[model samples]
Target chain A: MTTIFGVPITALYGQLVVGLVNGCFYAMLSLGLSIIFGMLDIVNFAHGAFYMLGAVLTWFAFTQFGISYWWALLLVPLVLAAAGAIIERSLLRRLYRLDPIYGLLFTFGLALVLEGLLRYKYGVSGLPYSIPDNLQGVFNLGFMFLPKYRAWVVIAALLVSLTTWLIIEKTSLGAYLRAATENPALVGAFGINVPAMTTITYAVGVALAGLAGVLAAPATQISPLMGSNLIIVVFAVVVIGGMGSILGSIVTGLGLGLIEGLTKVFYPQASSTMVFFIMAIVLLVRPAGLFGRER
Target chain B: MPNIVKYGGYSLLLLAGILAPLVIYPVFLMKALCFALFACAFNLLLGYTGLLSFGHAAFFGTAGYIAGYLIKQSSFGPGLGILSGTLAAGALGLVVGNLVIRRQGIYFSMITLALAQLIYFLYLQASFTGGEDGLQAIPRGRLFWFINLENDLTLYYVVLAIFLGGTLLVYRTIHSPFGQVLKAIRENEARAISLGYDVNRYKLMAFVLSATLSGLAGATKALVFTFVTLTDAHWHTSGDVVLMSLLGGMGSVSGPIVGAFSIVTLENELSDKVGSFVTVIIGAIFMVCVLVFRSGIVGEVSTLYRRVVGQREQ
Candidate 1:
């Protein structure tokens, strides 16, 4: 009933929720990308493909095997983590010594392979995945009616992001990861299995994408293209955030998502380009990103 | 590296361009030539300057759309339409290059890609782009008010001339003093800076030139096909040009031409047979190229030739 700048309060809140949910996904994906970049020194361009695989696997688990969304949320990440580990050990390891750009190129090819295979199998159509029965209804939050599934996505993403941040910042393993990222040779000299750590780091990063994919499956259309499309936006988020710190990516991602939501309220046409517009401005003002230290 | 080998290679390419249209499908050859020029343009930045732009398609596709709009709506002559398109792309290059030159390596690639996607989104939303359906039924239109491009044969020679002209420009640029400075920056940026060369200025120059030439190819392709679509601007087109440059041999003059022709022919053959799996195959080729053939076809051949000659001398 209330109006904010000519747009209904309900509409504004609704778009904000949508933006927040989208931001959560961006946070998770960029967090994974940043972590992988820190450890492996590669951008892991296949991250989007892995995310798509997460969603696709969720769809497959549900329709073919009668696996519920609950089970998928548990299993998809594990499966993708395994796949990530294998890809790192076999394909990515050879690329560490080359220019970091080659890593981006190689993973891009990997993404194409994944997206192409799925497209060939499923066609370009978006296969529907319904929200579970428990999370189907909406919560009347006084001002706006919020879908239960979307609320769950936001909460779950925050939990995952916070847990990841804690693990890297507070835990001893996180210390090793930070150390390895800084100087792998010194870490290796300390008798740590640096290569294995790199592999695990990639796997964990990929698992984060998988988790994001699963979170996104019910909220959006499940399609082969879902990841590639989203990943570019996340890249803008990463650029804006500067991949400097875990908190930076998480904060930037959510913040950009909110900005995008506000844009939708005033100028829906620019919603898509809003993040990019911000990215250009950020690059001009602080090329190191909002939270990133200049390397 | 010898002048005789270089001149002989150009002569051979010219002869083939003249004779091949008669033997193969002219339209297909025209497509390959356009792409060859595009790849050559891309190679100028990647090979000589060590800048990997993942958004060259922004220039290519934007130019195509602009050329199509001007020729179709404004009724501009084809030559003027293309020139306008090329200049527009150069201007875009100037703006984008200025923003991205501060970043290096993967950051550079990512920024270029993101900016290109921004352009892509704008085109998708713009009324002139025709959104998903793309700009269609563009006229082939005559050049110089007399030379008709409606005929496929007449157009093939014209396309060949344009391709050669673009390639020649790239060749000249690569061998010029400016190009040497680009190579210096590529090899060692810090060293180049120490040597008193303004590295960013040289990079910006290369980016604009690369973008303009890529625009030339895309604008010509619109006329040859008489249609301009969003596919021209898609990131996939950017990746395709990268693949062509990588597969051909990035630094060599003949590499991109060879790479473009090979990829175009391969895509043409595979699209009909594999249908939906063409992307997978292209991706597979990309992975293989990066993993096993980083030196590329030309680079490998040259290395092998040098090795054999050294062995004989020994």
Candidate 2:
């Protein structure tokens, strides 16, 4: 095997794959955060909780009903979306008129409640979800061995993020969302049912997090504490990518993942913080973020 | 008559704090006082400047590490070590605050958290921090040439002086014209800018001041505990300080100290009773405080007192 930058090709490729997989989660989660922030002006701090909820729920579905991974891929989002909708209507809706800080505080509370409930039910230890029979094996690419499940996760997350971007940016529904985000009153005046649209938008965003969680279940440990750790990193991704641009978030997520992977290969010590280190640099050069427009 | 009584009541409270450690466990009281100072420093940003920095643990924890390292590894005494730690934290705050203050509201919070996490990672990797074990078993050392901090009584008085000094500094800042400018900026930045005040400068100053003071508290804490760990610098520590300020009363001078004491006491008691659910409880409190008591405990009490006095006069 050849060496790149004094590291084995396999080692480099493996870290890159890991980075891509992590990036996919970042993109999906950050996409959700950006979309919700765009329309609601509320930073949904409970998003990680929702993602954790997805993983836990998937585990439950499998254990209780013998539901397979294929079924979970479809079912988890619907369940999480329904939960998200209910939460929006019941608690989140009330804080729309207040400072955006209130939304953050409320969602933070929601996160604690959700995580606490999960921890209560299933202790801090993680539960394992088996790789599906079809994607259980590894494929050897000349230089590296690739896990089929991880590749699938990256492809699936890419598809989800691209589809979300298309629906919000290219389609008529996307047009309506853009209008609603920009001028809710005007959109409502035009008979767009802005409130319902807002509710749906939030649900869809959260459902994205759920879908990511499902994908992550097999790759990482399915634990209640997983989301809290990941969300802060995702927030940095959002900051670096700029919440204003959809494509920016996707590209930044993937790019940052690659950078992190490279760091792991060359300097394992900095791998954990490679994304944030880049974020600091980005902030210094472009205070509004690379894609964020000056407000 | 009532105004004089209120003033007298505050003085009595201060007197009690000075005298309490004589009777109670000085170590616990010292811990509380250090945390109180930390909370007040945090309040300077969130309460006065309206910037909710979620990464103050960087200052608090990093300073503790620096102070600990200096006393244990170097020739410097405790005072010099603490000053160096505070300056280090202040320098870090300046760099971070410059970057974060560009964004407003939730974005600011995220930026601070991310930057703090970066510092955490740096510390984790740095040789001096000792990673997971952290820098432990630091010498408390004497304050000057005479006072041995190894004695609980001597340490308690030292901590008391620091806390009192910190509290008075915060008080002076709150009453200063500079503080009024910060309040103005917090209430309405555009208006303050229109009024010819350089809002960003005021904010950065406040941020640096808060970071320095938080570092001072952390440095003192390291001396008191004779150890410094990664837990102090973690994002959760930042969140804990936020909870302290919010619980105490954001804008009130004594509110953060009260908030810090209550929260520390509550956590100690509750964690003893129900080990794992403390976070859930704290989170619940955060939600409740944000929704129902935005002005916080001190703010609410003061308002109620004023109202009751008005009723009596009527």
Candidate 3:
């Protein structure tokens, strides 16, 4: 039995694994938030609700139509993308030209309404989306018994986040998005359909949250409230990462998740507030966030 | 409204307020009055200062807990408890406002919200709050070392007096030179700064003032209800006040009072019948208010009144 810093090493490794798993979800959610904020200039307060919808609708598909986890993973994001499109077309489209606070307020209302409706249909006692038979085994990673499902979750989340980062930062379409973010009017002047582009960008951003939801279903209990509490923490992440950078969100989220995990290992009570404690400190030190560029 | 109509309307409203306890349930009115005070305090920042402090319920609910605990443990008059709660809230505002005012616009809202949730988590975990059971059966105590507050009617008038005092304080602040500076900062911060105002200090002061008043409301509510709970400090309460201020009309003195009364009545009406549907209903109301009723009930009525007055002049 090996020990590090006079503490059991296996326990440390286990907490680190859990932290990485938590980090995956945080990274995915904050990634979506950063994308929407960068392109559409709206905070997407309903991002958490959309994440909950992903879990709920995926669970819905499973129970109603016997859709497997694999299929629902593909289907849920598309379904939520359509919903996002509709929301953008109906409500959010009117808000882009106004004060951004109006956008924040609009999404806040949408979140409460959506969560309330879900709770109305399915009582607060969360439904379970169990691990598939294939993903149930464990891997003895030398130090700890790592669950196979959790590894898949981390891989899948990282892949999704990486692909999103590449699509927005590397490809030609990515160039347009980056350009669009800087000056929409200028981008529009170049024969680009900025409105349609803005709408699609928002949908994609929401789809990323939906993808995160599907990934999180087996990790946590599938509940209508899955997103509400998590969203505030994500908001703190967005604040700490600043709204200016995409990579900032992904990196900060993962880092904080690890920090929070370490706090759990040392002092369980402070685990809940550790990220926020970091958030306050970060704001005091760098008002624009770690990777934020002063605009 | 003309001077005659304005003064007459105010007199009539006060008269109705004085008589409301006779007609309406005193407990219900006390509830409304407390919420009305909370909303108005919230309005002072949002309506007048143009800083949307989303964490106000932290002050409102924390004060309730403090006041309730003091009244339960000590033999001090309720006035002392309320005062201490209010000052403590002001101190909290000073700290929170320090962190939050560093960011502007949407970030300001998010910071306030995050900090409020931090407080909520603290209250949730702290033993002093009594957790799920809450601080129950708090004493109303003597209002001024003389008047007994155990009686329902006495408590109602006490709440009313506090409500009036809080409203008048906000009213005067809105009309004062400091308020003018705050309003100038709200309308255009850069312009206000260019004109040589220490905008941060003004904003922080308004935030503290709003918080202290909200604490006053919460303290009164605890004494009135004879208990305090986490619900007082919850984000939902913060959202409710935002809804009230917006629905009644932001940037107006009387808007939050109307908004608070209507929402409390609406909650009273709907909670029994629909239960869970109340959230959905409130959300829908929020959507509708933001979408079309940006001016709010009182704001629109005043606009109409002004239009009619202009027509008469023409």
Candidate 4:
């Protein structure tokens, strides 16, 4: 029954939870984008399309094969990664030698094709996916009620992001990936198959998007257009976080998400554009981004 | 000898374009001309300056709204309204360009897009834009004192004049020393900076010039159609312009014009038959253009022409 800053405390807390949930998705997707941009110097504009693909693919699996969310959590990323590898090998490989702008254009085209095809088959309307039975209940957390599904999403996403960070920063494979990103030709001369590594890196980045998409299906509407909206925001997050650092993207994404949530509770009109407002301010102050090193 | 013949061929093609509206519907031709100008203006930055802005819709659509509002609310004629609208867009570009020009490559594109979206949200909330319905029922108004733009023919000639003026201006800019410096920066910024050129200033000038021309086109378009809507200001409009520029060929002067006309004509003819499939076809064309026709229609033709001339000379 307490009020904080002229609004009900419970309502404020509820929005904060929603904000955190949204942030989790932003962190995951922007982290993937940062990794891809850092390594390839190519902005993967079709990242949203891949995310949409993940949701649609999950829906298809559920309807046809009765695959539950548990199985989807395992299978979706692998499928998306395989698709990403094929796209890189077949289409993206040709663009590596050209200007980075061409990579953006090519991916933009790919996104349109993917979204259009999905719209053609499924229409613009979304399909509903239920949360698994085990996570159907809600918990009273003293301050506010929390949905079990949302809590699960936050924990799972954090774990996934942490694991990705550890693998890339700590492991030998991660070392090799980092080294290849810095100097592909030198890495290749040292007996690393740099081209194959590049392909796999793109796949891993795309797989992260797919994984996020699968997590999102139960929380949000499973629609083709969903990814398009989120992708633009994620781009802002990536810019704010600096495209070179994975941890920067994660922290920025989550932080911005909470800020947006707070705005919704305090001032509803600015909520939609709060993230962009911050982005503009960040751009003016530090063109290289908060966490990015200047080129 | 062959060079003269090629010049003659190009002149004839220009003559054909000028005379086409007489045979075809003038309204449709006017729409195509507006879009052609818009695409050309966009190409000035992307092709010549090597800055790919993803928020051009902000200028185009905002100008449309401003022009629409003036014609609807004030007694100002279409000419003054369009001029004011263009100035508004140019001023906006100056501010936005200053902020965004500091970043290069993908970051620049992202900044433009996000800023444009912010403008879009502003328009959505502002009472002057009429919210969702937009500024509707805008008057065509008279051009100067005598010419009535209510007639389709009068509007067509007015649009033609604007398009011609814009094209010539762009051509002059391209041939200017400033444009040469821009190209140098585009090819290699480090080299240009080392050569003591202020690359940021050149980029900002180009951005403002492109935005002004695009705004002129959009303002004229609002007068011609007598309507301004939120659709014009959306990110999709920005994407459409980019697609047109890319489809035509980035570096060539006449490419975007050709691309704009062809795309508008194709969409008009096919939309009734295919419905939403137009998006798919456009996307396919984008893919095909990026993958197979990197040089674009005009670029390819010029290359072929040069090759043929060389063979003949030999």
**Highest lDDT: which candidate?**
1
- What ranking of all candidate models by TM-score puts the best one first? 1, 3, 4, 2
TM-scores of the candidates in the order shown: 0.99, 0.96, 0.98, 0.98
Among these predicted structures, which one has the highest DockQ?
A: 1
Model 2 ranges off by over 4 Å: B1-3
Lowest lDDT 10-mer window, candidate 3 chain B? B139-148
TM-score of chain B of each: 0.97, 0.97, 0.98, 0.96
Ranking 1 against 2 by TM-score, winner:
1
Each candidate: RMSD = 1.1, 1.7, 1.2, 1.5
lDDT of 1 by residue, B1-314 (tens): 57999789878967977999789999999999999999999999999999999999999998999999999999798899999999999999999999999788888888899999999999999999899999998888899989999999999999988988999999999999999999999999999999999999999999999999999999999988988888999999999999999998896978988899999999999999999799999899899999999978889999999999889989
Better of 2 and 4 by DockQ: 4
Interface RMSD (Å) of candidate 2? 1.5
Summarize candidate 4's per-residue lDDT along A93-121 as a digit string, tens digits.
99888888888888888888898888888
Of models 1 and 2, which has the larger DockQ? 1
Native-contact recovery for every candidate?
A: 0.84, 0.64, 0.62, 0.61
DockQ for candidate 2, C-alpha atoms: 0.68
Q: What's the true lDDT of residue B184 in model 4?
A: 95
**What lDDT score is found at residue B39 in candidate 2?**
98
